[model samples]
Target: MNQGDKWTYFLGCYPLYSHDADDNRMFRIITSQLIDAGLCRQIEILNTFGVSKSSVARSLRKYRADGIEAFFQPRKTRKGGRVLTEDVLTKAQTLLDQGFTSGNVADELHVKRDTLRKAINDGRLSTKALPPEYTTKSCRTTIDAEAAKNMGTACTRPEERIVAAFGVCDGAPVRFEPCIDIPKGGVLCALPVLLMNGLLNGAERFFGTLSGYYRTFHIIILVAFMALCRIKTVEQLRGHAPGEFGKLLGLDRIPEVRCLRSKLRELGSDADIIKQWSAYLSKYWMDQDPQAAGTLYVDGHVRVYHGGLTKLPRKFVSRQRLCLRGTNDFWVNDATGRPFFVVDKTVNPGMLAVLEQDIVPRLLKDVPNQAYDKDLIADPFLSRFVMVFDREGYSPQFFKKMWKEHRISCITYHKFPDDAWPEEWFKEQKVTMPSGEVVTMQLAEMGSFIGHKKSGLWVREVRKLTNSRHQTSLVSTAYDMEYQKLASCMFSRWCQENFFGYMMHHFAIDLLAEYGTEQLPAGEEVVNPAWRQLVRERSSLQNKHRYRKVKFAELTLSEPDANDENAYNVWFSLKSSLLEELEHYEHELEGVKERIKSTPKHIAWEELSEEDQFQRLSPGRKQLMDTIRMIAYRAETAMAGLMKGPTIDTPAARRILQDLFITEADILPDTNAKILTVRVHKASRPAVNRALSLLFKRLNNSEVIYPGTDMQIFYELGGEGHPQNAGKGVTQTSPK
Candidate 1:
């Protein structure tokens, strides 16, 4: 089209003439636009472009109705191909700097092999004088096993993802037949405890079955029994006679160390189910006895990872009195040392974190409102369930938040009270420990607000005054509970700590089950180590500046200008030197201020130092093993609970249980009567023997069945009234 003057126009995909295109059918459209712009008349336009006047009018009608959008084809762009990210490039460059070949760096960074080849070909990854490939060795590239395992071919199925792990394969589980005697840490004593706690039934529900002769019930029995014998590591089975433990399982041989480890790993794979099962078992415990749910003790136990070279986060190990790389596990136990459940702090978050975020919320969700006092909840206000922990959980925000949000109460020791109670406030009263032992303590009561002033409340505080003027205060939210009982609950927090100590020594509760790790979530925020270093360096520089300032003042404070020329010159030189030093210090401070501005305060886990992101193992397997150990400890505790009263104190009862658990017993199975008789050998100590007899009578009343055998277990003293050689040995008698 011409505009009456000689106009030069470059037309490709037209930018200015957007409302018209090649699909307009003729130049009539262009002619109409020309007339609309007063470049020409409608009839003159028809003549100029060699088109009809009616067509020009019609084109004008279309332009007025449809507008510019109707003339253009849809625009599009390509997406989701290769991602040439800065991170990938930086990593590749770093690898090259570290002497890795181009191919090796490409493989390491998971960049496509061809992408790296193209990068070198296009000069994106290499320069001419010192190309990335030429600067490094010509090493062959290899795929990462972990990476290969994650991504697979079209033939791979989702179900076939986990390749079966291979180790020294032990034989399948098989029974040794009847009459074969195995000491097995005398697992017979633990029979009632298992049956009482639903370990056998629980395993079936949670773990299901194994293909071998050993069922879910068999593994549960074996692990608990092994724990009783202090056989912590499965490798310990190497020293023990497998056949001896086999007899306990009604098998020809106990599953060897390999098989046992395999079983635990298998359980770990189904960690979710086992976790649910643990909850199920704990609920059963509380259901059997409602009082067990009254007030629970919560604490975190550190299990140091001594075997691995992992750079896991450090936790304070109380017993070791040092910070060590380990996992932090929070455990919940009832008043009498019975385990409720434990959750692994996979990131080693402290007890208070786990309590508020996980344990307390879970407890509140699981229990009915006013579980301790049902009537209190009927008025549309729920009664709080008490949790007794140490002073570590004594944050005002934590206490107030738990109460207001979840209606959960906490009884941690008072942190940093101003003064001890007066002597007159102390009154002698008997307080029963969680173990059922009653002790006389001088007690006092008062009230104080906890947490922040706006969100906190006035709660009862109990003080236990000692003979040496030492006083311990316990803060409680259970205002209506008896003062003595509340004091006992507060003091009973030790029972949970003791429970941790006992498990560590007996069941290897502190042992790390696996040394495998996975990458943490990318969004998890952590302090940048580089930033922290910068901060500390700044502080150090500031301290040095302060010292120099003080020194400069000290030199200048008493000196006056000397009347003598030599003295005046000396003073002037010294003052000038001091001023120069001050200037030097000020320059350093300014540089530090600039450096701090560039440093990041926090970064996502992905941006963390490589070691910090994945130095800790996943808690799945540790959790599985932990649950097994909890059941074992629970069994032992059940026996201990029954041995209470004047005859046996807690320590004495423990000794009795130890003897009973280790004693040899005769196995007698009556097919017709559906009974399995365990005639236990007596203890050397007469008092223990008496306690043993009483414990056996109680266990026999439970009439627990042998796992896998389904035969009711009956306990009896092998030597009748005589304590001589009672626990040494017993013969399996055939029932008539």
Candidate 2:
């Protein structure tokens, strides 16, 4: 059959127009099977398939005799006088100029490669021009050999001066004696926890003294304390008096914003060391309290990029409901909503991919061993690492892999269920929140299983029905966990979201850590924008073709059949035109398909030329900020746990903590008794004053001395009347 006659066979489930040569050849194979199986009777096939009985018979006989090669294939027929369309020729030239090979251009324009070559040879089209974006150029960065050689071990301070300042430690360990001499302002409240947690504890002047008044420890402390005080950015220091904030670090004056950032760069240069320190603190936390890993919440927080230095791929910021240029940071927090750790996802990988590839593997190695104690958790099932996340980790295959391969159990929302649980399955239960509030809610579990295999070895899926006829499904491998408890763990993924929200609102978590682009590694894989555009164009054309085909069919089916004569010719004329247009779109779609087949989904960053090659952002400052913010939050959270009930209202505790951090208190140092007393004067609110009194007693009970002075910490309310210090008059008090 000719190409025109063969299109009449574009009927049945496998439409001929919708497939390529390979697929049509498979279609013929399938047809042979059906005819042999007695499912394809010639009369019925002809009636439904629009193909004549004679052609159908011929195709079946030829297919059986020749074993699948006898089916009619589309042939490349040259129209004797048909000239290339202006649009197609223009497109072909444009692609050729963009460095596309002649064969590629020919395929894109639906012309024979030989035809394109002849056109180029005859000077009808030029394949010599090159688009600027695709042209490669050498990037030269100057290197001062002497300076580059000496850069690593260059110490600004003389060795003699360091030995003089910090007495020469000839095998004597350099240690920071717990100084009860902590400033009693906003910093005193959390310094003990911060110090004990070992955030800036191990940081020392290993390479010798820096130029700033603050040592490395002091610089790190200043950064953390700034975040604790809700001074989210360095620029915010402009609003604060330096002397006032400096007192928090026991310094006469705080370092300038530039100096602090410089120190951060100096200290943060050893990223591996800092990360090890951070990991030490996390492991220590879990070691002290294994319940912290009772259920770990994992999710991604997209920090939108507002700068224009380099364009990041657009990520959907769920908060704003708008996709914007940003970086994705996957955070893993414990059941208490305190962050375990956060990973900066530089390449914009999806939440699930990052979880399995980076987050989970790390957790499996670091946690589980240190997080669970034999005596702490009575439920053997609870001892298994239970990771809670949202629907991003919802693949049944992933869940199965997590359980079988790594022995890591997870809780996440189930996304692919068709029907909601019946109303009778749901019942109200009083669930205790992490904040200790008893909440009454309707929750249900059918113990429904998931997995393609039907041996019933699958995750238990639970659902929570709402008044609006909505159902929220949670699937977990924690089969031994109580249904209510499982439901709670899954729903608590919001705590991580809340953590992101809180950090963004109060700590400027969304702020750019630093606006600097770094050199991307050569040949790093990146999405091919040109290939993506081609896919988009192909999809658009396919959609248009489908739409026009439907329109053509509708016109032909609805045509007036007033008689089988000249009266209905107008509608017939319209149908015939639409069909011709539909055929043109189909042909163009085939050309697009051919083009898409050869384009790679991702190309090396170096392939895009120098300007596009260096788009990856630096993570140094962001990592610094994330570390400090987590420590500050952890300390704040610990203090909040103590002030839960009558001492401080649980709900308003975060605000109260902020107030305490910003409050002006009198620093009373009783070095004679080895006790430092902080006399907090009258607060703006009496409740705050009362709450601080209780918190002070609680901190004193811990007997945590300050970092450098030998005195037990003490907190006292003003003896009688006191004036508002306005962040002044908070000098360290001496012992009588």
Among these predictions, the greatest TM-score belongs to 2
Worst 10 residues of 1 by lDDT: 134-143
Model 1 per-residue lDDT at 417: 73
**Which regions in candidate 1 have their CA more than 4 angstroms from the true location?**
1-181, 368-382, 419-421, 450-456, 521-523, 538-602, 721-736
TM-scores, each model vs. reference: 0.66, 0.69
Model 1 Cα displacement at 165 (Å)? 18
Give per-residue CA lDDT, model 1, range 136-244, as digits (tens). Answer: 1111111122223554211122232222122222323322233423354356788667666666655655676664444566676777777777778777788865544
RMSD of candidates 1 onward, in order: 36.4, 39.9
Clashing residue pairs found in predicted model 1 = 175-251, 175-252, 176-251, 176-252, 396-451, 681-726, 681-727, 682-726, 682-727
Q: What's the TM for model 2?
A: 0.69
What lDDT does candidate 2 reach at residue 189?
A: 73
